[model samples]
Target: MPQPAGFAFLERDGVVVITHHGRTATTLRGARAADFLEDVEDGDAQEIMARLTGNYRRGNERQARNHPRNKGR
Candidate 1:
């Protein structure tokens, strides 16, 4: 997947930290993540972040904006 600019995440010490545009959007600690993820139908931490911060959309935009069809329009 294409990565959004300035989007970074780190999972350390059983805690998940998400940053978008260089600012923290949310954090998931061990206890909370366990509780939350357990109920999730079929999603892992990385998928959660990708949906939350719209990283995929950004990546698509980044890629599309350079296409010839988008030029000067």
Candidate 2:
């Protein structure tokens, strides 16, 4: 799988705004924002942000697309 890019975040006044490709994708606030900040600091920020925004692939698309039932679409 390819690495996720173009994911950025901004935190202000206890609000966390997550953007993908320069557009707003999700906003985290309160406890969620705090948790996100911690996670970003602890691990890969791009992966975390992609997962939080539901933008990461589940690694099943290729198999699903090649399944017998899905053949000859």
Candidate 3:
């Protein structure tokens, strides 16, 4: 079991970038609040983020699909 490395949280030009190693997470706040990762450069960051978010959303969708909070939808 290895501990994870420290992560860097950066805010630049209204874009917040969270990076650890080569992985990155990004968030934008304003009229449109969007949260995602910065992983479209010349590396495996896109693939890594795709896999990570896929799993994350899958679990969330599963929970939401059965939750009563969204019963009308």
Candidate 4:
């Protein structure tokens, strides 16, 4: 799978942070991903942000803009 365009990270000490252009492909999904990896899904925004510290969201405009023509939105 391709990268999600953006993501977030928590330092060893637990400081939530975000990345506009992510370095890795394929975001780590699920609670662990949201909790530990710091990446939050857009749909899950309210739920995730409420529990977590901040937004580690990525790939919003990029996904909308770069969607594969063959995929058929």
Candidate 5:
């Protein structure tokens, strides 16, 4: 899958503000903010942000579409 774009994060005063395409998607505070900072330092920030904002795919779209029950739809 293509990497997600337009996701950004800003940290301030123990808060993490996440945005997509210039709009706020979610805000992380306290332990959540700390964990997010740690994860971003160790992995793909874009993927992480996309997942946090409920914007990432579940990797089953093609399988669902091809299932016998959905084949004709």
Candidate 6:
């Protein structure tokens, strides 16, 4: 089966970005990366990526509700 292209791991300022085919698909903070990666490494790359970013998505949604533009909506 085909698979995702190699991912690039980059840190600019403090965030670590994971990209495939040169497109950023997700990010994790440098501090959380080690333990988070260790916990998810056994899964397929796509699944592992989804697990990593899934929490980010949920967190973003929760945070968006608090954003000034979204507040009281």
Q: TM-score, each model?
A: 0.38, 0.74, 0.29, 0.22, 0.72, 0.39
* Total colliding residue pairs, candidate 3: 0
Q: Which ten residues in a row have the lowest lDDT in candidate 3?
A: 50-59
lDDT of 1 by residue, 1-73 (tens): 5643454566677776777766786777878656545534475545556565553333478678899999997
Q: Give residue 49's error in model 1 in angstroms.
A: 1.2
Query: Pairs clashing in candidate 2?
Result: none
Local accuracy by lDDT, each model: 0.62, 0.92, 0.46, 0.43, 0.91, 0.63
Q: Mark the 10 consecutive residues where model 6 has the least summed lDDT.
A: 50-59
Q: Model 4 over residues 1-73: C-alpha lDDT tens digits?
A: 4423334443443444433344322333445554644435435443443344344334496676677873655
- Model 1 misplaced regions, further than 4 Å: 1-6, 31-47, 53-73
Question: What lDDT, from 0 to 1, does candidate 1 have?
Answer: 0.62
Record all residue pairs in model 4 with backbone atoms less than 3 Å apart, i.e. clashing: none
C-alpha RMSD of each candidate structure in angstroms: 7.3, 5.1, 11.4, 11.3, 5.4, 8.1
Q: Residue 18: error of model 2 in Å?
A: 0.3
Model 5, residue 47: what's the lDDT?
92
> What is the clash count for each candidate, in the order shown?
0, 0, 0, 0, 0, 0
Residues 1-73, candidate 6: write the lDDT tens digits: 4654455566666666777657676878767766555654665656566556553332377778888998779
Error of 6 at 20 (Å): 3.2
Model 3 CA deviation exceeding 4 Å by range:
1-4, 31-73
What lDDT score goes with residue 36 in model 1? 42
- Best-to-worst ranking by lDDT: 2, 5, 6, 1, 3, 4
Candidates 2 and 4: which is better by TM-score? 2
Per-residue lDDT for 50 in model 5? 92
Answer with 3 or 5, whichever has the higher lDDT: 5
Worst 10 residues of 4 by lDDT: 18-27
